[model samples]
Target: MKVVTTEIPATSAPPTLGVLLAGGLARRMGGGDKPMRSIGGRTILERVIARLSPQCSGLILNANGDPARFAAFGLQVVADDVPGFPGPLAGILAALDWTATNRPEIEWVLSAAGDCPFLPRDLVARLHEARARENAQLAVAASGDQSHPVIGLWRVDLREELRHALVVEDLRKIDRWTARYPLATVMWPTEPLDPFFNANTVEDIAEAERLAALDDAS
Candidate 1:
């Protein structure tokens, strides 16, 4: 796979719609939107938007309840069609459905967790490159030995199949769903900072600040 560090050329870019998955019921971090939590003096979602906006043709937020809370971000808020906060897969489904309807021209959707403030700048470019080279239906990001199923490229055309998995099969695990298809796992270096680091709890917020400094220096 080609190692990309931003500065992606238009020729190698994918026609992808970015979906920030903020639909999860953050049980580990109390109950509110985890992405709303501030790190490095900015909301996690804010940092995420800054990282992803340039890589995608468009961006959407998948969150339940009142959309007004995220109004400041100016992103289209898409609620899950599955109803009730099932999981991140529900958020991905909502995004895929929205993309199919609103962005008919786009063939791919790149899904990323909203609470992840340190997403790699080359996320979109690298995912598309690996997926195309491997002839895979899906592509996910990995760091260390752990695979982040949520941070991956999805096929817009598979929205129906995904809905079936979520609703009929009751499949909430991303790995289980992606396992049925050919997938490419792209790795990113962790020397400077793990690009996929996510703030999942109250304590993680402090760690994110330290990581933020490392990221800035790099």
Candidate 2:
């Protein structure tokens, strides 16, 4: 475990890399990349990249098979080190590894699902405030009555703990690993827009379109 601290300006310096987890099997959506699904005349992944690119130092995509599909996005494509479709934790680990190796100056990684195109623009800022104020090793975002464990800022030093949890402890749930560290949750009001809204099912895509239309009207 290595810990490297660097100056990460809340408004300027790059503190972390934005890792988009897109490796899901997507059985719920008929086995295609959820991020590639269209919403409001643009792919959900494109929208997500647009929103996330400015939040962190750089971006990476965690997806399996034919990395070329995402190559057009111009990001490094990483796959899970652990075999079998374990879940987002595997993607988190891959992101952590990328951070530890390439971005040694940074100490954290910000993760979010590719389908969450409307994620808050101030996500990194809010998470940094929560992590610093609480002295937490991890800070996850929550909105309304929902807690998004996958949408979080993770300390790069905890990479080993996460690996152990996934491999030996058999901890498949994100909350389970987050519980072991000093963690904090940043709550966001759902008013105006629920920043964490995701396009999981067909109905969700339609609702996103409707929401986009309503947003434009205002």
In order of appearance, the predictions have TM-scores of 0.94, 0.92
lDDT of 1 by residue, 64-119 (tens): 99999988888889998987678989999899889888989989999999999999
What are the candidates' C-alpha RMSDs?
Answer: 4.7, 5.3
Candidate 2 residue runs with Cα over 4 Å from true position: 1-14, 215-218
Per-candidate clash tally: 0, 0
**Poorest stretch of ten by lDDT in candidate 1:** 1-10
